[model samples]
Target: MSVQIRNLQSEDVLTYSLPLLLGDVRPPLAESKISVCNRRNNTSMSWPVYNGTFKALVELKPGENIIELMFYGEVVELVLVYKVPPLTRFVRPVYIKCHDDPHGDFQGPEDEDCSAESACQRIALGAKLIQTLTAEKLAEHGFGRKTFLLETDLDAKAPACHVFTSSLSVACAQQMTGAELWLKFACELMSAKTFTQKENCKWFCFMSFTRYEAENDSLPKSHIDVLKQTKGYAALGGGGLALFSTGNLHCWAETLDQVPLRFTDTRKIDRSKFMDDSAYRGFYWANYSTGLGSSLHELGHTFDLAHTRTGIMARGFDDLYRVFIVRPLRSRASSCSRDSSRLTTPSPYSSRSRSRVASGNSIGAEPCFLRPLPTRLHSQPSFPDVIHIEVGFAQLPTKLTQCYTVHHYDGSETQTVVTRQSDGTETRSQLTLSPDGEWERKDVKINQLDAGKTGMQVTACRELPMAPSALPHSAVDGPDSVQEFVLQGQTPSDAGAHWHRSSAVILNYHKWFNEDCEKNQGSSPEITGGYITSPCGLRLIELRNHDNGTVVHHWEFLHDDPPTEFKVNLDKVKDVLPADCVECSVMVEDSRGNISKKKVHFDDL
Candidate 1:
C-alpha cells in the first residue's frame, strides 16, 4: 500500500490521490478504493475506486496547511504524519521508592547479623496487612482504581523510619503539623525488638534539645510545636527521634515515668530492667506505637482513616508495656496448632466499621429471625402467572355456625371453608377468635382452592333438643370475623416422553385421617383429587403447607429440557389436601437446566 499527498490553493480544490493495491495484481485497476484519515483526532473516511488510484478533494483554509497520505486495504494500514503538534504530553501513575542515602544508615557492618530473617518477616507481614485492609475498604466503598506502592527507606543517622505519603498534599500537611515525625515515632515503637535484637545488640540513638531565637521571632514553646503549629516557637528538640523497632528498650525500673531515658552504664543493665519500662515519650505512630492492634491500626491512619470509638482501629491507650510487664501476666508458649490450621485453610474474617455492629448469642437467648432459602418451582423459561383469592365475612354473628366461600380473581366459587360440626366432628373446635374492643376477629383456613369460584353466603340458624334430659336451643350464625388466602401455580412441558401422558401426586392429611377414623368408623372421607393428561411424565419435588390448617390445591411443576413432549391437564389432576394451613411451598426438579417451585396460600381453604 502507498499514500499520496497534494497541496491546494484558495478558490481551488486539489484532489489528493493514493493507490489501492491488494494481492498480486499485474497493473491493477486504474482507480482503486482507499480511505482518508485525520491523524489529529483519529477519524477516517472510506470510498471505493474502480481504477488504480482514489482521490479526495481538499480546500485549504489559511496559515500553514498540511496534508497527509494514508492507506487502508485488505492487506495493511499505512500512515504518514504530515502535521504535528508543537508540544506533546503524557501522564503516568506515580511510584515512590527509596532514593539515594549518602550515609549507610540502614546498611550493616561486614559481620553484622542482627537477625535479618525475623526482621524481614515482620516487615513483610506488615506490608501484606496494609494491602489487605486497603483492598477490602476499596471494594466496599467503590473507590477509584489506582495502584499504591509502599516503599521502605531506613534512616542511618537517627535510627528513625517513617511511612511517608509520597503525595505532595500529604507532605504539605505533614510539614504544617509535624505529623510525619510523630508517625516515625509510632512506627519505630511498634516495630519492637525481636528475639534476636534482645539477645545480641544494644540498639540505641541520641536525642538533643537546642534553644534558638529567630532574630526577633518567638521562641518554640515545646518540642511538639516543630511538628505542630502552636502559639509560640521557643525551642527545637532533636536527637535520635527513634525507638527500638524489634525489641524492648532497657531502662531503670525505678524511673519508668521519665520522658527521655538514658542508661548510666549500658553493660550494667539486663533484660529484666528493659522489660519493665513503661516509658513512652510522644504520640508517635498513632495506634502502631501503642501496640494495641496489629499493623492494621497504623495502616488505617495511612489510608486517611480516623480513630473511631468502636472499630478495629478504635482509639485506645497502647498499654502494652503495662499489660505485659507491670502486671506480669503469665506467658504461654506460642503454639503452631492454631497458626498451622489457619495457614492451611483460610476463611473470611469480618470486621465492622464505625456504625455497623455484629450480634452474638449469649445464655438464654435466641436468634432474632430465620430466613429459609427460596425454592424453585418451574423449569420453563418464564415464571407461571399467579392468581390470589381471599374469603371473608362482612360482619360477625352472635353465634358461630356459618360458612364462608372463597372466590378467585375471575369472580368464581373456588372453595368453601365452614365452621360447623359434621358427622359428630366439631370443626368449630379448631376455630379461634380474638376480641378487639367491640369487634370479634376470627381467621380461618380453606383448603383445595380452584381457579374460578362463585361467592359464598352464610345463613343464620338455630338447633336445639329440649327434653327432660336433652340439650337446650342454640342459635347459629357467622363467626365474628374471617379472612382467607389462596395460591395457584403451573408448569410448561414439551411433547414426547410418554405415549399417554399421565402425572399424579398423592395428598395425605394426618389430622383428617384421625378425625375421620374416630368419627366415621375408620373410613376416610373422599376429598377433591385428580390428574391431568400430560404428554410426558411429571415430577413432584416439594410440598408446602401451614400447620393445623386445611391444605390448598396449589402445586409446583418440574420442567424438562427441550420441554417434555406431553399434553397434561393441570386442573383435572389438582387435589385439596387435609389440614388448616396458611401457606405451603413445593419444589420440583425435572430433566432440565432449571428447577420449578410453587407456593400456595391456604388462607382461603
Candidate 2:
C-alpha cells in the first residue's frame, strides 16, 4: 500500500487540509493506522480513514512544521512551513446598558446620575488602554490590536441592547450564571447579524453595564461549558468577548475558544490609583482609576498571553503604563521550544502500534529535549515545591472557630482548625498534611485571632527521603519507559436489572509502580530529572466500550494535579448495547508522563 498528500503547497499559510490516500491496501488493514506528527510542536493527530481516504485540519505554527505521515508500516515525511503575516486590525462595536438598579427607578444614559458623557469617558479610557497594551507591540509579531467602538443611543427611550435586571446581592447575581447571560446576549447579536461575514474580522467584542453588585467574583463553570460548546459561534466564526460592569472590587477574564470574555467591576475603580509608572509593581493595581488595567489584562489572555513575572501579563493590575512600555513581546521560538519538550508522549497501551512505526523509518526518530522531573511533590504538583493560600477576616459572636482546608496538587485535600475562646485564649489544631509537604488554610474568622483581627501564622518542614533509584548514565528510554497496568473492573451493586438503568461502573486500579524498579526513582535521567515527581501525578483516565469501539467516558487533567481513582458514569453513553457487552478498555497516565492501558469484560466490572 502507498500514501499520498494533497492540497499542500510550499508557500506559507495559516491552515490547510492534510489529506491522505491509501491504494492497494489489503484486508488486515483493520490494523492499519494513519498518524500526522508535527515536528515543530512535537504534537500529533491520528486520522481516521473512510473509503481509502483520510483528511484532517492542520493549523500551522509561525515557522516550519515537519509533519510525518505514517500509514500501516510505511512513513512519508514533508515540511509545511509558515511565515508570519502582516498585522491585521479589527474594530468591534460595544453596547452598554444597565439591567437593574438597587434603589427604585432605572435610569438611562441621559439621566443626570448616568450621563452619556460619563459612559463615553469610561469607554474611551478602555480603548486607550487596549491600544497602549497591544498596538505596536503585537504588530511586530504578526498579530493586530482589537479596538472597541461604543455604540450608544442616548435619545432613544430604550438602550441598543436590553440589560437584563439582576439583584444587587452577590448570591442573587451569581445564581444567574455568566455563561447563560453571555449566551443570551450572543444569541441576540447573532439574530441581529451584529457580526459581519468578513473572514478577516472573526473577533467581536461586546461591552455592557449591569447594576448587580460583585466582589472578587469568578465566572461559574457553566461559562466554561458554554465556551466549550459554542466555541466558534455564527458569522464571527470565532467566539466573542463580553465585559460587564458590576460593582465588583476586582475584575477577571477567561477564554472561550481562545476568545476572551472579561468582566470589570466599575465600582472598584479609584482614579487616584492610576500611576504613570506603576506597571513595574509585582502586584496588580485592582483599584486603577479608569479600571483599564484589568481590561487590558483580560484582553491579553485572548491572545494566548499568560501572566509573566514583570509585564502587563503579570499578576496585579497595577503599573499598566510601565508594563506596556517596558515588557517586550514574548519570543515565539523560546515558547515553542519549551512546549516541544513536553509534547504528549505516546501511550504504551494505545491501539496504534508505535513499535513498528518507530522502527520502520528514520525520518523523525530523534528525541526532543525533556526536562528533569521533580524529586519531591509539593502543593502545586506541577511545581517542584510551592504552596498557595488565602487569608481573610471573619466575625463570630461567642466562641470563634477557624477551619483550614489544604489542597494538594494531586487532587487530595486535608483540613485543620483553630479556635478562640470568648476570654481571648486561642487553641491550635494540628493539620493533616500531605506526603508532599503542602497544606491550605480555610474558613478563617476575623474575631478568632488573639488580637481579634486577622493575624495567624504557622510553619513546619520535613526532610525529604533520598531518591528511590539512581539515575541512568546512558540515553533514556523514550515514551515507552514504563509498562502497562492490568485494570480490573466490577459492576456496581446499585446497577439495576435493566441495562438503561445502570448509570455507572466501579473501577479499581493498582500496581502503579513496577515490582522490579525502585519505587522512589525514575528509570532514566530524563524521567528522574524531569519536572515531574517520583509518584507521577495521575494525568488521564478513559473508558471505552469494546462492542463498537465507542468511548463511553473520558477525563483528562493537564498541569493540575490528577486524581488517583475515578468513578465512571455511563449515562452519557448513547449507544444501545446488550447486557453482555463485554469488551471494554481503560487507559491511564501518571505524573511521570507515562501512559498505560488495560482491558476487561462487563462481567469483570
Name the best candidate (by lDDT): 2
Per-residue C-alpha lDDT of model 1 across residues 1-605, encoded as one tens digit per residue: 44433222222221111111122212445434445444444444443333343333221222223334444444333332221112111111111111231111111112122122323323333332233233222222222111122221111121112222222232232233234433443344335452112221111221111111222343222322221322111111112121122222111111111101111111121111111111222211211223223233443333222232222333222322211111111224422122222222211111121111112111111111222334566754885677876779576433336555432222233233345333322232222221222323344543223212422211000000000111111121112111111111111111110000001111111111011222322222111122111222222222334342112222223222212222222332233333344455443322211233345443322
Candidate 2 weakest lDDT stretch, 10 residues = 497-506
Q: Give the C-alpha miss distance for residue 59 in model 1, angstroms.
A: 62
Counted clashes in each candidate structure? 70, 27
Per-residue lDDT tens digits for candidate 2, residues 260-361, read 011211121221221111122111122332245555554443322233322343333443333221112333343323232222333211124334333332
TM-score of each: 0.17, 0.27
RMSD for each of the candidates: 36.3, 26.2
List candidate 2 segments past 4 Å from native: 1-89, 98-113, 136-175, 194-199, 202-207, 212-238, 246-286, 304-317, 323-605
After superposing candidate 1, which stretches have Cα over 4 Å from the reference? 1-121, 137-147, 151-296, 316-605
